[model samples]
Every structure is written in C-alpha cells, then in structure tokens.
Target: MNEQERMTRRRFLKACGLGLAGLSLSGYMTYLFGGTSVKDVLKSTLGGTGADGFRALENFRINSVEPTPNVQLADYRLTVDGLVANPVTWSFAELKHALTEVEQVSDFHCVEGWGIKNVRWTGVKMRELIQQVRPMQTATHVTFYSLGGVYTESLSLAEAMEEETLLAYGIYGKDLPAPQGYPLRAIIPRMFGYKGAKWVYRIEFTDHQHLGYWERYGYNVDGVTAR
Candidate 1:
C-alpha cells in the first residue's frame, strides 16, 4: 500500500479500536524461537504479501468479523415497518415460497482493502419487499437491523430500491451460512461490506438517514467502492 492508503487504513483501524498498525505482536513471538520474532506469521493471516504460498482472500465468500448469530430458519421472523402503509412480518417459509428466487454474481468489497469477487447470491429483490409494505412518500431511507445492536445500517431509498439490491437468503447455491447471515441479509453489490448488514432481520423505512455502526465510527457514509 502507498503512504496515503496506509494512513487511511490506520485511521480506520484506530476508529474501529483494532489499531493493528505498528503494534506488531512480534514481541510475543521473540521468546518462541531464539528471540527471532514471527512477524511474517501475522502478515500471512491478516495482510499477507502476494507471495506464491500465502492466500489473501477467498472467492465467492461472505464474511463478517463480528460475532455470528445462531439462527434457525423455522423460528426466524423478518419485520418490515416504519413509514409504510402496510407493515408486515415475514416468516422464513413465506419469503422462500412466495418470492421467485434470483441468482446474481457480484463482487463483495471491504473497506479494509480486501475484496471477494463473483459471489453467487440468491434472493428476492429489495424492491419487492418495499413494494409489499408500500413505503410512504415521506420515506427517504431504509434502516436494516441485524443480530448485534451495533450491526444497524441504512441506505437511501433510491439505493435500496435498485434492481441489484437484494435480501439474500442463499449464497454459493446453498442456504446462507450463519457466519454470513443465515435466514436473511441485505446484499447491496455496490457498497462496502458494512452496508451489507449480516444476520439482518428487520427493515424500517424512515425519513432521515441513520449512521451505520461503522459510519458512526470513521468509515464514509457514502461507502461507494470502485466498480
């Protein structure tokens, strides 16, 4: 990474309280092998150099550093409320059986500088959900709630209504994995990962935008990644 990008990464990490910049765990490894630090090990796992053996990231993967929620689809409930004429709570089966599933291949990018490409996401369109609830004219943003309280995020009405925005229920041609938000989750291909709320269960349409968990920290509110 260049100096400017390095500065941005450090700033972001500091805001997230994981400032893994220069505070290498190299000191802890010194005692293990004749005082020679194991700096390369840390690099390999978190930010490996593009060498022949080290794998940086996996393709068609969905990931979150947060604690994954344990969910059983039989009991899952997705609530759609706020600024809507008809509020609805959809059961897992209702969504799965009622909506025609669509599969999309898109890249998932992280603000921390890594990306997973061509993720096969299968779900109903985000617009379809909005259509069911009939978002009021006053609704300007749609807030998503996930397993963790800090996992809340929002998208502008225009962004949330895009054809590519999805409430994904499956990935890689199978049921969504718990680590990747099983039952349901928002999958907006254009934004950074934080905007794709994991373990998402609730959608609330509102008049004003809410700062997502990361946005409240230091990440950009307009988290548009390069196409």
Candidate 2:
C-alpha cells in the first residue's frame, strides 16, 4: 500500500482500538489472528444488556475516529446507476414507500472475531432494488458507497441478489443510531461485517469488481466469514 493509504488504515485501526494495522495478518490470516485480540478487548469491556440481545456496545464494532456525518433525511438521496437499464435516485421517504421492507434476524460476524447474534434488521432486499434498476447483461458486480464518501464495498451480482442482502434502515425495532450509520447500511449476512458498507448512499452496477476500502489494505476482497 502507498504511504497515504497506510496512514489512513492506521487511523482506522486506531479508531477501532484494534491496534492490528502493523500486523501482517492480510487476507484470511486477518481473521485467524486478529479475531483473538478483538475478542479479548470485547470481553474486557462488557456491561449491561442492550437491545437485540447485545451487551453494551456490542451491537456493532465502534469506529470512534470519524465523527458521524449529519445526514438530513429531507435531503438524503440514494442513487442507483452504472451498468443498468434504469438509473434512478430516491429520497429516503420515497425509497421506503416504494420498496417493500422486510425484517430478518441474522448473526453479524466480524473478521476481528467479535460478533453479534440474532440482530433484528429491517430494510429492503437488495434483489428488489436490482429488479427495479435492471442491471445490464454486462453488469456482474454491485458496489455500495457510503455517504461519508470514503468507504465503498462490492459484491458479485449473484451475491447482491442473495436473500440475506439487505439495505437496512432500522435495527432492534428503532431507527439506526448515528454510530450505526443512521439512515442506511448494507447487511450481507454471509460475509464479515466489513462487507456491509454503512451509511450507504449509492449503488452502482459494474462490469468489474470494485475493491473496497479494506480490500486495498489486503483484507479479503470477498470478506466472507471464515466460519
């Protein structure tokens, strides 16, 4: 990685309190060794129970470095474009009103070893959105972009169409908290948490795979959970 990217990663790891940036735990090895350290820290910080059966702040790994972006619902728009027959953008209200929202209970696996089980996520299925946009035949991948503008993640078209792929807006029967990406986040239950781009604002259908923020740092591109 370049020096700037290296520094960026260091900042992110530092924010997560992981301190694993210097380790050579690239790709699958990241999950093998990094998981142990994350679990230890999580166990030591435990407290009272929270919603969705999570303990304390266990609902999601905290990214304490970057302040949460103030997203205005009235001005928020999710754009779908790229290799698709129909390009469209939707306001938060329109997205919710036009798409069917579904709720599902699933486990969120983190590559760092910590995880939350049976998370109650409410959102629109990605397949439904894909059907609406109608990807071109050449479109084999789908990239999700965060509103923060720095974070992006991708999935194969087939993977994006998976039953568990959701564009979530609520968790535990409440609107998402600022720390949890507020307005929206992508949930790919089968992959590690990093594959789920929080604060999603754009969906692009592409002919080629797009490397995500962590992928450039040598984390597995697919980011499927090891277990």
Candidate 3:
C-alpha cells in the first residue's frame, strides 16, 4: 500500500481499537508480508473514508440502551415556552395529528464525520411551529432539549425556517427508532447532525445566540462541513 493509504488504515484501526495482531494471520500475512493491497482491507474495515466513516463511528454504539416504550401518550408532553407570546404544551398524539406532515429527502451531515442515507423524514415544519408560537421580532435562535439530556441543538431563525427542515417523527416509512430519536427529532438539511436534536422534549425561543451542549465544547454550532 502507498504511504497515505497505510496512514489512513492505521488511523482507522486505531479508532476501531484493533491492533495488527488482531487481524487474521492470512489477511495480515498476505497484506503485510506478501504486500497484498491494503485498499481492500481499508475499505472493508473503515467502510468509507473521511466524514462518512467518522459519522458512522460516532453513531456506532453496540450496547446502547433502547428507549422505554411510550405507553401513555396523554402523559407525554412537549413544552414550547420561553420568549414566545403563545407558549404552549402539546401531547404526543396532539403533535402527531395536529400538525401538517411534510416529507423531506435530504443529506444528514455531521461535523464529527459521516452523513445520513438520503433520509425521508415526515413531521411538522419548523416554520409552522414558529407561526404557532409567533416568535417576537427580537428572537434570533431556538434551543432544543431532548428527553434524556443526551442530545441538544440550536439553529438561527433563518436556518430553522428552511422548507427542508422538520421536527421528524418518522424515518423512511416507520416510526423513528429509539436510539435514533424516538417521539420526535429535528431534521436540518443544511446543518450537521449536531443541529438535528433527537428525542426533543422542549423548545425555547431566545433573542441571543446560545451555545448548545456540543457547541460548548468545540463542535461548530452551524455545522457546515468542509467540502
């Protein structure tokens, strides 16, 4: 393998916590000793290069706990308060039926690396929600909070109003997978995955830019990937 390809393989193996010794002797010997191409090994091991591989790894958690079954729809509530003139709370069923359903076919990119598989999302539009809430003139951004404190995201008013964006409740043709974000998840096509908060429970309108949980660390709030 060339130097660059070898370096990439090393990075992938390191990320996967696999050592050279861990590889099967036949594959290792053929590639390492016999000089068989490592390109196949890289492809098989890393899936794909760059952001796609990074994103797949970020979402990979083999032992992730499944979300509890949502048995009581009446008890499940989504609060839309803070800075809005018409603050309101809606139950799961209310949200499911009250809002107009819009389907979106968009790429889901992530700053950490990786993207969606041209997902089709069905749910209420962010513009419709903004209309319902009537964000004041001073409002600049919206912050989302998820159920388990595991995810959070924010978006500027303009970005949130994009037609492609939606608070998705279904993926492909079925209800959202729990690990993927159950009752509801935000889908912002232009921004990275961190902006698409999952299992959203509350949304708050604000007049100033506020850093999300991931953004507070080092992740970009806008999530614009390097092309």
Candidate 4:
C-alpha cells in the first residue's frame, strides 16, 4: 500500500477499541490470507492493549512517522563494526537471506506491568550473528543503535549471546509493523520492552559497559525478572 493509505489505516487502528485480543486475531487472519496489504497487516499486528497504551504514551502519534537514517530498509544498513576483525555493512535483504529463520512463541512482559499474551516471532538467533562476527577478546558488551539519533541499548556479551534473543523480522506470523520496528527489532525474552529496542539499526561490539537511552533516563539496565 502507498504511504497515505498506510497512514489512514494507522489512524483508524489508533482510534479503534479492539484492544490486544482483537488485534491478535486480526494479525492471525492477515497471516493466513496471502493477499493482505501492508496496512492491513499493521492494523492487525499493532492491535493490542500494550500497543494502544504505548501509542497513548506517545500521545497517539505513530512513532515510525519520522524517518530515521537508521530505520529505512533501502537506506538501512546494519553495521557490524567496532571490535570485529571484518567490519561489515549489511543490507536488509542481505541480512534476511544470510541468517536462518527461527520461530518463537513466548510471553512478552513490559516493565510497566502490562504483558501481552503469548505471541510467535520469526527471526534469526542473535548468537548465530555473534558467532559470525567473532568478537575479539576485549569485546565485553553489545550496544544497539537505532536510526534515530542516540537511541541506544546494550547487552553484556553473555546476554547478547542468548539463544532466545533474536533480531526479529516478523511478529505474530507476518512482517512486523513499522511502529513495532519493521525490517528489524531486538527481542530479548523475559526483559522489559525497552530492553527489546525498537527501530533497531546497528549493532556495535563494545568493550566497555554503557547505559542506553532509557537506562540513562532511570529505567533498569539489567532487566532481569524475578519469578
């Protein structure tokens, strides 16, 4: 669909009251039917209470409206640099093809105390990428950078290597919605959503510990949950 049509659908979903359950159903239907448009997929995938609340937090504005240098698939490049021996730049399609696809069904919990019911995600294992990068002995943390200026997050080498952590390309069985971080987004299960950085653009292998945007703003950096 064109940009204008996409925008109109986003506006409609924002104004609707279907909550998360209805949104999940919509996403399921869209995935099953091959002919659904991008706008329709978005209306369904983004249809959830957590999304509604998040949109409200942003004053109902679609967060992806602004073009970030890092988020565009055409202009987007995931730079695997810093401490790596072979610093690489990957196009979205290149990365999509290079990585193996894996499916995950897990509960998504937000630090705000709201949780989405089980959802399935399709993406590549982050460990696989790290293995490919082969960080040097000095690299201790993996810092994530988004297209928008200075929006960053970090994970210790250990956290970054988790088998469950993924650089996700699809959600609920379809391509991700832009607001939900299309092209790619990080999904670290059991952590707060902020730790799952949205609109992800780059991955920097770092030797020093660093605080991300939210971490610097007082959200917990080590987002481990206590059961």
| The candidate that achieves the highest lDDT relative to the unseen native structure | 2
| Model 1 bad stretches (over 4 Å) | 1-65, 225-227
lDDT of 2 by residue, 114-156 (tens): 7766788899999999999999999999999988788889999
CA lDDT of every candidate = 0.76, 0.82, 0.72, 0.73
- The runs of at least 3 residues in candidate 4 whose Cα sits more than 4 Å from the true structure, single-residue gaps closed, are 1-72, 225-227
For model 3, the stretches where C-alpha displacement exceeds 4 angstroms are 1-72
TM-score of predicted structure 2: 0.76
> For candidate 4, lDDT tens digit of each residue in 1-227?
99999999998897685576689886677655321356534654566345432332232123332364434568877888888776678888888787789999776766655555456788998898988888999999988877676577889989988878999988777787777777788989878777877677778898997798777768778876522
By lDDT, the better pick of 1 and 2 is: 2
TM-score per model over all chains: 0.71, 0.76, 0.68, 0.68
Off by over 4 Å in 2: 1-59, 64-66, 225-227
Q: Rank the candidates by lDDT, best first.
A: 2, 1, 4, 3
Candidate 4 RMSD computed on C-alpha atoms after optimal superposition onto the true structure: 15.1
lDDT of 1 by residue, 72-97 (tens): 77788888999999998888888777
The TM-score ranking, best first, is 2, 1, 4, 3
Pairs with steric clashes in candidate 3:
51-114, 55-113
